[model samples]
Target chain A: MLLTATLSLLLMQQAPSENVDWDAEFGVEEVERDPATGEIPVEPYEQNNENAGAKPFTGDDMAETFGGRDGIRQIAERFVEINFADPRIQGIFAGHDEVRLRRTIFEQFCYILNAGCDYTGRDMKSSHEGLGSRKADLNAIVENLQQAMREQDVPFAAQNRFLSKLAPMSRDVINR
Target chain B: MTPVFNHFATCLMVAPLALLPMSLCAQEVLSDTQSIDQAGTFPEYNAKLLLTNAVSAVDGASGGGISNWATIAGRQETRGVGVQAHVTAVLLPDFFYQSHGVALGIADRIELSYARQNFDTQDVGAALGIGQGYMLNQDVFGAKVRLFGDVVYGNTMVPQVAVGAQYKRSLDGAVASAVGAAHDEGVDVTLSATKLLLSHSVLVNTTARLTKANQNGLLGFGSVSDDSYAIQFEGAVAYQFSRRFVLGTEFRTKPDNLGLGEGDWFDVFAAYAPSDNLTVTAAYADLGSIATFTGQRGAFLQAQVAF
Candidate 1:
């Protein structure tokens, strides 16, 4: 036992310390570089999309699956109810407009589902730019979304299919 | 003593067989939520935490590519029981090495593992006058318990630590004795520390092993030339590129007492988890030298299933 304790201490000492600044270690610039100036090159979104290939969901498919626009609306309402009640995510809605928020969420889901809904809500990046959202918050929303879909009798496969399409949006909503 | 050791190894091999009936019994008592995934209402069966835990290593302990780590296998749950099985194949230039094992993780604390390794000497056996296609078999039983700290949310400076031991016995005792091995059975104690720097999406683990094994007990334990326990180090660093993919490299130091010129091992690997229950790892390993043969480099493939 004493030997085990000594070896544990030695191995722990071998690990890298927390004080080392990784950003500095990698020589990353403290200031953000603009891509237009080519200081920090950013890959074109089109190229990224090319690698990702075509998305599976389409307006016609989503429209048929959700019974056109009405089913999407029902899903939206139930999602809001779950979000308001879920402690993990309820705090994010503390000061939001209930009716408008529901409408926005409904439109967002419809658009992601490619249900041919003319979503009038703000763009995803702008809407979530300053909420200090983390991956934890996004995960909470996903959990609530799953619960809402369950209440609405959505098949597990269908839920996953929808989520796969929407999962990429995390880059825009989290840690922005 | 040898007969008793063989009996113990046999018992370890049969333990998994006994677990089958118990697993079926437990299934009968599964909660409604546990059966939700089976009913096709839930897509995920295990939903504790993401990428916070690692799959079982070839030796059946939770770790990186080839080295044992401090973290437990399966998803991160404070009070959950998890079990995993793995099949690993390492293709060397002059030998084929394979290991199959099962592990049990209890309440995110204790880990018990058993692995059986087979080393096929291929052409080397003929050259060494040990008969054609001679094989070496060994059984390793490991037990580890987390001692302190949490890798994911530990104090800024401390890493998660665990203390473990592996009792290994070679089945080919006669052949082991011919190779000048001092003993056919030996025990190894290990201390492992692991840390995940989520901020940088990097994972690191360090382990120190106190052992007398030669070539991981395939060549047997200790030797006529050296009989004391030797300290070995294994280290790994991985980058979590995405939720499902991890790219890593490992370095493990080995003793050079067996006169066969065994050297340290290194590998670069990529592990992919399609789901919480299934993982596949592919690696290019440079095992340095084994049995006097130089540059034993080859590919490694491992597949694991956990619940």
Candidate 2:
């Protein structure tokens, strides 16, 4: 009878339960009391907070992630370096030195980041103010952006989101 | 003394006789009709001339010849002002009727028009009437400006284009408002590029219209949803056999917004000028209608007189 009772108890323990045992032998630490407000404990940023259940921010992790400012900067740099050879851009920015090109790339990057910086480089209206660009020029810009995104392996979803925001501006930018 | 007097008179008479042939020769040379014909052919006029007198077909086809006749006449003499009143009465074999009123070329730049359409099918059958046959009417007032001229012929600087806008309002407000329309009034702006391809004997005109009006100023105003924009293309060619007559054809496309009409229309037209001021035009038009309504073809006639 004792052996059978013990076997029945072991079978019951194998069933699933809604309750979680934090004090089990799996190495999870248990807190006896909550930390006092305004008197926080000093812990490393990466350490998982037992009280707030938050993880730390790391620059290396940010560099690995393909979003936010760091990722945008990297993508912008690659795009400027690779697609600057496009004929459309060459025609529009003819006689522009490397410094001007770099400045334009930086302005684009800043605008994409929404970093609250003044993009003194002319808006679409002023940049194409009197240029009288045709539909071909607008299409060429879209193609160049697409190729740059593909070459840099920017995720498809991110690229689509950017294009949706950029597409409507074509009416203002292309006049011919 | 009497003999000397006779000699002096003879010398004077001989001198007068000698000059007569030279004067006659000069007059004959100067009075030739060739110079008069050349002057008559090329007269100087300051007003804009109409190189052609043709309507833009529904499919964006230009009628034969250079329809710029209207523009040319408007620009020729500053006092040469004219108004055209046109009423198109369309009778469908199925008993539907449409009518339009046009007051065009007022001030040589502004045009005002009104159109009304009725969809009646009682003569056909009861099955054609979904609920009640309605008479739809629209009022359109248009204003156009001749911003610049000689766009095609001038140095390749600016395109020969004209910009205009039409403001339309529907008469059946209750019915038009019930369809989730944007407003009772809609405005459509058009930029038309007209190029004279002289080598091809053709005028290729393309108009990009941003419009929210539903029925081309028919069915009253604001009957169409606001989410529609159309690009209409028209090409017209005229082979002139003589100075007074021309035969031509046109093809054009209109937007199908209300799902009550056919896709596009085409026409073959011939025009004759009986005099410098009077022009008569006749055309066979195929204007398709809504549904399986075939045989929507008809004939068109127009008379234009300019002073």
Q: How well does chain A score by TM in each candidate?
A: 0.63, 0.51
| Candidate 1 root-mean-square deviation in Å | 21.3
TM-score for the first chain in candidate 2 comes to 0.51
Clashing pairs in 1: none
Tell me model 2's lDDT, rounded to 2 decimals. Answer: 0.46
Write model 2 residue lDDT over B89-202, tens digit each, in one string.
334455454433333444334333333334354434344443445555556565545455432233222334556666667666654455444456677676655543332334
Q: Compute fnat per model.
A: 0.00, 0.00
TM-score for each candidate, following the candidate numbering:
0.58, 0.42
Interface DockQ per candidate: 0.02, 0.00
DockQ metric, candidate 2: 0.00
Q: Best by TM-score, which number? A: 1
Docking level of model 1 = incorrect
